[model samples]
Target: MDLHEISEKLQAGAAKAVAALVQQALDEGYPAQKILEEGLLDGMNVIGEKFKNNEIYVPEVLIAARAMNKGAEVLKPHLAAEGVKATGKVCIGTVQGDLHDIGKNLVKMMMEGKGLEVVDLGVDVAPSTYVQCAIEQNCSMICCSALLTTTMGVMADVVKAVEEAGIHDKVKIMIGGAPVTQHYCDQIGADFYAADATTAAEIAVDYCAKVANG
Candidate 1:
């Protein structure tokens, strides 16, 4: 079957179909990286774009992401055997005092969709914890989500902690959530602010590429 058909199936959120097609592609001697990029990530990129355009909502995006995960699961062993590695690693969590995780979870899925390895720190994450994870994981970026205004201040603390850890130059910071703003991102000395999960993932992928190229 054509790889684009796999992409179409993935975009349609046919989890079983996508998993089967991914296995078929592997059995047909398609490179795991090619299948991941052309089939799974391609479908996710479309969903991300539609989400950014507001043509799709959370439920649809979630479904597409689920399909992508299913396909990825089937392709994982092949990918590892082929020595395929993620383009970058990122640590993500909701800031301290904020237990909201729906947005954080969505961002994680979108980042994974873009083929970035994600270290999910879960909710109620402290600034120190973020710094520690970035340092230990050698992450290229730290992403913070805060749905409450009170908890958004923790993002600034994260920036401070990264600077204090002496890795500010090496680690980029991205912030998001309902109360987050570009102005606030700048105020906290963050590298990027995304209005939504789709944009957040795109910005992260682009930033990682730029960092790698440089």
Candidate 2:
């Protein structure tokens, strides 16, 4: 299939078809980066939309994410062989006291598919934990997801802890999830609020690009 057709299949969550397109691009000497951007990222974006709309659940999303990651894996080694670096570096986690990660996982996949390197700190992450990861990774930004009303309160703590560490200004904070809203992000002093995974990746990438070029 052509690139657009392949991307359409990916949007429809066709894992096998995506994997095949990835292999095809590699065989034809197309740059791995191009395939990853046009094929994998584009496909996972579709899957993410399905997830946000409740049209698909975690299992299907995970499988689609796996397909996208599989494509990314193929390009990873080649990227390293050519010394290719990604556009952005981000640290992500589910806020403390919230065990839910389906949303966080979706954001992670979407970020990776968009060619950003991601460090996932996993679920139920404490405020200090998020702070520590940011310092250690020297990440460009922090993305926090909270699914429960109770845990969303901890996001402010995360912001404070990171600021205490003196990395708050160095990193832009973005917040999202089922229960998270723009007001919450503003209240917590986040740099941006993403309503869904696609917008998260887009905003994060564009924000960092502007930073990098500035």
Candidate 3:
């Protein structure tokens, strides 16, 4: 049976439909990994692209992500039983003193949609928290989000923390937010800077794939 319907329903933000279809696909003996990749991730990738291209907005991405989450819930146990590992692991959070979380949440959803295991540290996260979580979780990347200029400086502090922890070579750093730019990313020595959620997820996936292959 074609799993494209699962992708279509997910893109349409039909959460219950996506979940039910995922169960059906499993009952039909399709591999959980295939359903996740070809069905859920495929739909999310389209949504991400549309979001990046200005064809869709935040609300749409949120709903689609919700649908993806619903479908992923159905596949999670089966995936574990199949020994399907995540593409990569990354920790994400908003910087200290910043109560903003919408951007961080969006990046988390996009990363999850790409099959990356994300550890969300939530808003108002201290630099040391990022460093500790990366070490504890064995995360390959640390993604920092900050909407406030004052708080954005904490991202640089996170870089410093990682360097001071002596894990700079082990973990890549990605930074983004309204006030963050490639210039700021360069100035802070972050490994990647994304203009939007889609680009962030793309950068993360590419980085993780390279790390995996190497």
Candidate 4:
């Protein structure tokens, strides 16, 4: 099976085709990890780059993500049987008092595209919840999003909670959203800040790689 075909169809956002192709690849005896990395993730990397360059928009990213998800569903059991592991784990949520989730959802998709297991905590998540989930899930990263200035302060509280939990050295904190900036990230002592979802995924991948190597 030409995994490249699967990658191309996935990039074109053909969910059904991607799913069918993934099954065909498995039938052809391709490794599940190969299909996941070279087919689905390869396609999503292209979409993420296009999005970051402004060559594509949200709808395109969404469709491509859907395609990736479809392919992944077909490959999931095989991947598990093969003992394929995600690059890293992260728990993400919108801060307390913030109901906006579009940005948070995008980041989750983008992270998953990069082969990171993302645990989405949904909207209006409290600071303590972020810390609790990170500890419970054994996540390497905690990502917080806030679209409102009022809610942005909650991110700082999250950082404090992580510190209070004495897991500050084990888990990294990342903050982002419409109201967030690099300065704010610095002020709040977050380990990383991304202006967009694509960048967020990249940052996560890089950090996970470093941790794995060390």
Candidate that would win on lDDT? 3
Q: Give the distance in Å from residue 57's predicted Cα in candidate 4 to where it truly belongs.
A: 0.7
Each model's backbone clash number: 0, 0, 0, 0
lDDT for each residue of candidate 1 in 1-214, tens digit (9 for 90 to 100)? 7999888998889999999999999999999999999999999999888888889888988899899999999999989999999988999999999999999999998899899999999999999999999999999999999999888999999999999999999999999999999999988899899999999998999988888898
**Roughly what TM-score does model 3 have, to 2 decimal places?**
0.98
- TM-score to true structure, per model: 0.98, 0.86, 0.98, 0.98
Q: What is candidate 2's lDDT per residue for 90-146, written digit by digit as tens?
A: 899998889998889888887876778899999988888877787888788888999
lDDT of 1 at 44: 91
Model 3 lDDT tens row, 1-214: 6899999999999999999999999999999999999999999999999999999999999999999999999999999999999999999999999999999999999999999999999999999999999999999999999999888999989999999999999899999999999999999999999999999999999999998998
Clashing pairs in 2: none
lDDT of 1 at 104: 99
**Candidate 4 residue pairs in clash (backbone atoms < 3 Å):** none
Location of the lowest summed lDDT over 10 successive residues in candidate 2: 1-10
lDDT by residue (1-214, candidate 4, tens digit) is 7899998998899999999999999999999999999999999999999999999999989999999999999999999999999999999999999999999999999999999999999999998999899999999999999999999999999999999999999999999999899999999899999999999999999988887888
lDDT scores in order: 0.94, 0.80, 0.95, 0.94
Better of 3 and 4 by lDDT: 3
State, as a TM-score between 0 and 1, how close model 1 is to the true structure: 0.98
